[model samples]
Target: MVFDDKNADQAQSLREKMSGVRNGLKVITLASGKGGVGKSSITVNLAIALAQLGIRVLVMDADFGLANIDVMLGVQTKHNLTHFLRGERRLDEIVHIGYDGVRFISGGSGMMELLRMNEGQLSKVMHGLTKLDMPIDYILCDAGAGINDNLISMILASSETIIVTTTEPTAILDAYALIKTIVKRDNLHPLHVIMNRAESKKEADHVLDGFSEVLAKHLQKEVNRLGHITLDPEVPRSIKRQTPIMISAPNTSFARDIRSIARELLELPPQKEPGNVFSRLFSGLRK
Candidate 1:
């Protein structure tokens, strides 16, 4: 097939622009009102699924108190976020590569100490992150459940916040409560939802509807429904194997759903400017 010169030039220009802007590194923070809703599972598989589409993804396990993305992904720990926090290593040194080309930064055990860092340390960490060499397409922060200050900081910094919840009434209530807090605290609008462990589409819809209604009526905000993962046994089995469902059981329905969600997220228009020379230069100077 003959290539069109005009199209080729346009493609090249787009690539140049993307390279200049750092290629749209979107930061998506996943949080839950309560634990046990498979937040880490979703985060891991979603990263893998996105990477399957040739998108470079980094899953940052931000659940400081009880971090386990490393264990779930079966990545043996040589070093973790603690090393970076303690200035023993740089952020890039701690990244662990996993299935389907996903890279992860393990949230070291007892990282609650890092949370106590004075403003200077926190600023240093943030500055360090911007200087990393990897051109990450997405930085998925799997934050701890609840509305603590750390979690709030993560939510505010992220380009988008995904709230995972199950069909239980308590889960729904907590999800609403968390969104309400975010709205009031940040003065932000709707928060995204990922309904997990639903038995059917109807069940997922019910869960989404309940949250949407509350947000609309009570908070005067809209809750965007990203999608849902069904009650698939393959999920837990894959977790037990310490592998992502997208890699361990790609043919399973749960894997299919994960892939679908990844596609949806990828297809969404790029939100943040990927990279800029000024930002990179300043980042380098700060180091």
Candidate 2:
């Protein structure tokens, strides 16, 4: 197969941008204490929102056995991490372009071998990721729900983590559990809390206040509130239709909430000096 010269030029330009990535890449691991809390939905939408702000964004559907970013966007995957792990594909080969200019790497399901990869394989995987030719401003890792070695590694490797939860008691408790675990592992890692499916701002404020209070007293770590998403009927509809809410119903309240969250993240101060490059960060974690 022959490649287009113009495309190659553009690829070269992207690589140049990568080299000059001064502030580094912002890697955020979007995680939850449990499943079914709209974590994946938030991940996909937030990615699009960030991209819409003119920030080149990449989403790593790192949910492993339960990846859903591709399914949620209706993007068919010919090759995912499974093929890459087996040396059948490269990192760029497995990346899928999703709606609103968001690029993502899908995590194919039921690959027990992937979950149990040895050190050599792990090193290869990390090497592939750190060598991407495309330049990106943000990488949102939609990590699998709950705690595990992989999940812990991913979060610990990231510059920041967003803990998504709902107003439900179980969800809140589970969010706290995940936060406690992370704090126990690394207290200096910046943690952001996002309350999803909130019925009212009052409800969200109350829950977040109580949750933050408890976390401060127990973990002695202050959590940043990254805004909240309201319960919108159209969110599920958009998901069922394989479109992001930001696209299908851009005027909806849910879409606005996501955009707001994206803006808040963009307004955040960048890390000084070398920035947070995924390749550097993940490699250090492995060591």
Model 2 TM-score (2 dp)? 0.83
Report the lDDT tens digits of candidate 1 across residue range 57-106: 88888887478998888777789877887889888999888886788888
- The global Cα lDDT (0 to 1) of model 2 is 0.79
Error in Å for residue 131 of model 2: 2.5
Q: Best by lDDT, which number?
A: 2
How high is each candidate's TM-score? Answer: 0.81, 0.83
Number of the top TM-score candidate: 2
Per-residue lDDT tens digits for candidate 2, residues 1-287, read 12245333433333343333436777788999778888899999999988888888889888776677888898789898889888889889998787878899988877777667553454455445556788777888888877665566567656789999999999999888888777766688799999999999899999999999999999999988998999999988988999998888887889888888887887754322233488689979999
Once superposed on the true structure, which residue ranges of model 2 sit more than 4 Å away at CA?
1-23, 117-123, 268-287
lDDT of 2 at 51: 87
